[model samples]
Target: MGAPPQPRAPSRRVKLFSAWFWLYLVASLTVFWFAVVIPWLVITPFDRRRRFSHWYAYTWANHLHAVSPFWTIVVEHAERMRADQAYVLVCNHQSSGDILTMFSLRKQFRWVAKRGLFALPFLGWMMAMAGYVGIKRGDKRSRERMMAKCRRQLELGNTIAMFPEGTRSTTRHMRPFKRGAFVLACESNKPVLPVIMVGTHETLPRDSWVFTLERKIYPVLRVLEPIEPAAHDHDPERLADAVCERMTAAIEQLRAEIEARGGLEVRPPQ
Candidate 1:
């Protein structure tokens, strides 16, 4: 099997277009900002779950993909979802672009992000409005509150989404899984839904934004079969490790498939 493809350098034209895209993105976001806020504020009073916030945020975030025609996201196995069944979703954190890529799932789940990110001027406040959960690293008390809140959300029949690695990875190398998400799965008796994401960092590299058309950059999100609550026998550590192992292997397989098609490159858009 081939190793995961490395990031490719962008041509001069792509770089210039990226600069312009960013400009257009910022303006669009600014223009649409109020549309989300007004509805969120009105609905927060009646909808304790802020379910509308999730949909609004999902819609708003997905616009990031409208920048270029060549930039497309491929979603797989989405049919596995069933209406009204809440779940605990765990996915690998590859790049910041995931903030946008994830919305493509079109599934309603409260996101668990770092508390620091929730403090970013407008972005953080928007997250707050979306009712996403945030955790403070190494702050035991903060973690406790986060876990409590997540448990409550689960009890309310709302799905919870988290990156068990705790933070983003610049490459395909994932960090150790954190136990919080798995613990929730066990305690809440909710099945764990593992998702495999590939090619996100290459599309929007952590250290840089440059990308080349030398190969097609297909950001794929694959939702795997759910792991029943009994699969881990109520053991959080076992659940975490089991999910991690399967996800790691699945990601490797996905990358190998992509590599087989010739270096993540596709013919330039016509």
Candidate 2:
């Protein structure tokens, strides 16, 4: 064979003006935030220990995914997640959809996200009301505050989820791991749960506002075996490296599985 045929580009018209797509997103945000999130915020105290808001947010997120006709999320080994155990859940970031796909885990965790995400309109407001930690990158004071908040959350028997890459990978490749998440794990003596998310970039690539509806996107969320903090002897750098290696391997395995299936439509086992 001389050359393989390349994939066709998505229709620009459809990307820009998909009536159902836009309507679904708009209605999801407006109705859910106004009808559910706002009411919960009003009824609950900001510092309440019971995470009624997070549960509502999780349900809303699942509903949003369920309404998307072109997308399906399959989470594997989700039963490995324990309700009683607190963990530093570290995941590789690929696209904005990674955040949405994570809710499939259905595990209660406080997200450690960038400060800017905390400034968005409805989403950010909901995150704040749900008590997620926000850090201003490169700001020492902000980092300190974030770490303090994470430790406190752990003390309260809550898991903390962080994107160890610190930013989305434009090419869906693994980037250098950041130490914040590992440090939190080592300091708190919690297990580091490595979660690999694949196909998110295909669903919605970085810097692209439009959803790629050319093909059905089946995103996979795999929760690998957790690494105990004691194994790293409280060294965040080493723990980060180990977790990164495991995640990279897990991504490769996911890709191989997809290839074996000969398509991206294979749903991971329930």
Candidate 3:
């Protein structure tokens, strides 16, 4: 019998096209920011600037996802978000795309990002202008300043989003949770809202700019019940542990649900 035909490798031309597509999209968005977002932000009142910037960011993220043919995003329990209450939002960090997935919540919140991220040309400038908090790792003084800024935002009834894992996990398993977000929640007396994200790592792994092609990337995010500050007696360590446990469990459940639905296969971090 004749040898069976071998499966063909993905075409190099297609890979190049995909990479170029992302580069073009990024350039287009940067132009849109300078041409539209920046002009409006400059004219907006200081008091409303943060909210306006967040809205613009949310619009940009959604627009990017909408234009990407290989991506699909699903969010559950988003209605659990209470419009009247501000929370310390914490989530697992898997990929850079997690930021856009979080924006799918469409909630108003300032991000606690690395100081380096805030130094990027246009995006970093936008983040600073939008009043997002930045922390310099290993610098005690910077940490103090970041926390104080976060506390002020909480006092003003603004939510703050943080990735308690600190950095993207290299493997499917989550890295150790950091105490900063929990401490901020305790000090600010804001409830801790835990969100679980799955499938983002597969879509866009760490340190890579190219999108995985020819596959449907279904990223799922679930908003779990918020943990009231009183539940942990204002203890940051206990609060952190409790939140981490709940999020771990929730991720497992989400994985099982995805498996049952015959959607994209979610792999553990390496």
Candidate 4:
């Protein structure tokens, strides 16, 4: 199955540490939010694109992970992200924490996320404030509107980031990518940047509210070379498949490297 063993019972020490960690996280996060509220309100009117809001959100995420000893994030090939290019970023879905790890790339893109995420407490509100694009799941009208918005943002010279899987996978195996993001890239004539993430589902599952207490989580982020316009023949379906195939190969290659380095061992592929 290429999936890690299911969660085991937390020891008493783990339970205690998790409890303490959550409290510390919640309290510190409140401060992180409030600290930026004034700056956010001040910048919203002057900054037409809301780029500051985007930076604020990701900076908060990066700092949160930075302070937590439980997490060690390694972002590879970040320099591949250039400031001059506005790309339609195509990323895989691994876990909610993928936001923290992926967004740490700080690529200056507006996120395209599902509607329910905006309903989440501070995190969702941050997405709204950061001008992220949201689509209602299974709602055709909502999707159409979202596409229109993304197109406008692209024209305005803003990069767009999307998780084409639509939802997180339950295992190491990735879900099928939806076509919307690739369609947008073709329509806009922008490059498709594949962001591959590892080590999320094994630690932070979509259904779990509490993070693992005993295990230290290391999320690896790899940014491959952009799929240039010349590569896909301006076809969304072909582009989607090309991207999916490239990412799948890279994921397996990354797992092998991790194994070779004696890094945190991922479950072997079936």
Candidate 5:
């Protein structure tokens, strides 16, 4: 024994299945992007665009469920998400795959995405149509504009989804929560809903653009009990810490299960 025995390669059937799945996802996204998305963009008037945008988002998300391979998405404590309520929803930043988790909710919420995403052609236009508020982290003026828009959106009964870590982490360890989300909750006096997204990073890590598949590796979205902001408001840093701690614990527990299955360890991005 020169060395430990090597593992067998994936079977032909497995390889073929993966190929078909990739093709299906590409074809589906293309049709939806052009046929559905383009028409909605063209037909819907500027002031009334949100309705069409929401419909488009819902349809696209449902399409993902139809085309996804190898893994299922599980939502826990979903009752926490109420259609009648307006709250500030915050989650950890992981892979772009996390978009599936958010879209899977099928609820109408505006995203607070980085300005860069807003620069994409059709995607940027669609996001704006959907009433999404893009934030430019580089400029103070842009930061002020984003804060104002978020507050206004909340007032208008729209929920805002934000990633408190600012950027996706390469590792499982949670990054220091930023103060913007907490500040919004406090200033707006809206309830903050903490969401824990598990396993998305492993499903599609930051450095890799290729989609990977694994058994029982489905992603999980756990809606933790909401954190209601006091009328007087607490220190923004403290509120941010409390939210960060709760989500970090949930993610770690999930990581343990994957590790026990001999999956690769997800390290926090530096």
Candidate 6:
């Protein structure tokens, strides 16, 4: 028999076109910020900014996803979402695109992000409007301040999304989960919801902005059931490890399932 037909990858021209799409979207969002979002921020009441910003970001991100032929996002377990209750969302860090998935959840949650992201011109402004908490790495006071802000947000019945590993992982192996998210969850007495996002790394991997479509890329957002606070309320450090173990196991199971179904093609080595 003749050789089978190979999958048609995105042509360079298509990639280039998608690049322009991103640029145009960013530019448009900028105009959007200055013309609409910014004006409302300045004039709107403080309490109202949170809701408005979440709405704006969700709409903008959805538009971005729609225009970009680069990604096919499949959001699962959406029915499990309880908008009425607050949660501490924990997810693996793979690529910057993970940020969009966070906004995709369409919840008014404050993200615990590195202070560096707060420096990207329009992106930083959008983040600020979204009520994200910025943490200065290696600074104790910064960590405390971030935790304090997180606690307050949780108390207010607002969700908080955190990549407990602190930085993006370049491979399939997840970075060691940090204690911040677990500690905060314990202190705030909130449930921890584990999230698994596959295929983001393939979209825009570390040190490479040039989008690659070696294979059709479709990222999935799967939310595992919540992990309620431990009954003993042990030391924060110990509780953190327990939380990490749970997340690690969840990731492994998801990875295996994805591989078994042949849904994910790229499993970058640790």
All candidates in order of lDDT, best leading = 2, 3, 4, 1, 6, 5
lDDT of 4 by residue, 125-239 (tens): 7788888989998899999999999998888788899888888887677789899999999989999999898776655666764566465756688899889765879999999
Best by lDDT: 2
- lDDT (C-alpha) at residue 21 in model 4: 63
Alpha carbon deviation, residue 37, candidate 3 (Å) = 5.6
Against the correct fold, how does model 6 do in TM-score?
0.84
Writing each residue's lDDT as its tens digit, candidate 2 over 28-104 gives 77677787755675668754644777887888889878877777888899978799899999988878878889998
10 residues in a row with least lDDT, candidate 6: 1-10
Candidate 5 C-alpha RMSD relative to the actual structure: 6.5
**Alpha-carbon TM-score of each model against the true structure:** 0.89, 0.90, 0.89, 0.89, 0.80, 0.84
How much does each candidate deviate from the true structure in C-alpha RMSD? 3.0, 3.3, 6.1, 3.5, 6.5, 5.9
Candidate 6 residue runs with Cα over 4 Å from true position:
1-11, 14-18, 46-49, 231-234, 264-270
Candidate 6 global CA lDDT score: 0.74
Show where candidate 5 strays beyond 4 Å.
Answer: 1-30, 33-52, 214-216, 254-270
How many clashes in candidate 4? 0
Task: Please give, for residues 138-174, the per-residue lDDT of candidate 3 as tens digits.
Answer: 9999999999999888887889999999998777667
- In TM-score terms, candidate 4 sits at 0.89
Cα deviation at 24, candidate 1, in Å, is 3.1
> How high a TM-score does candidate 5 get?
0.80
TM-score of 3: 0.89
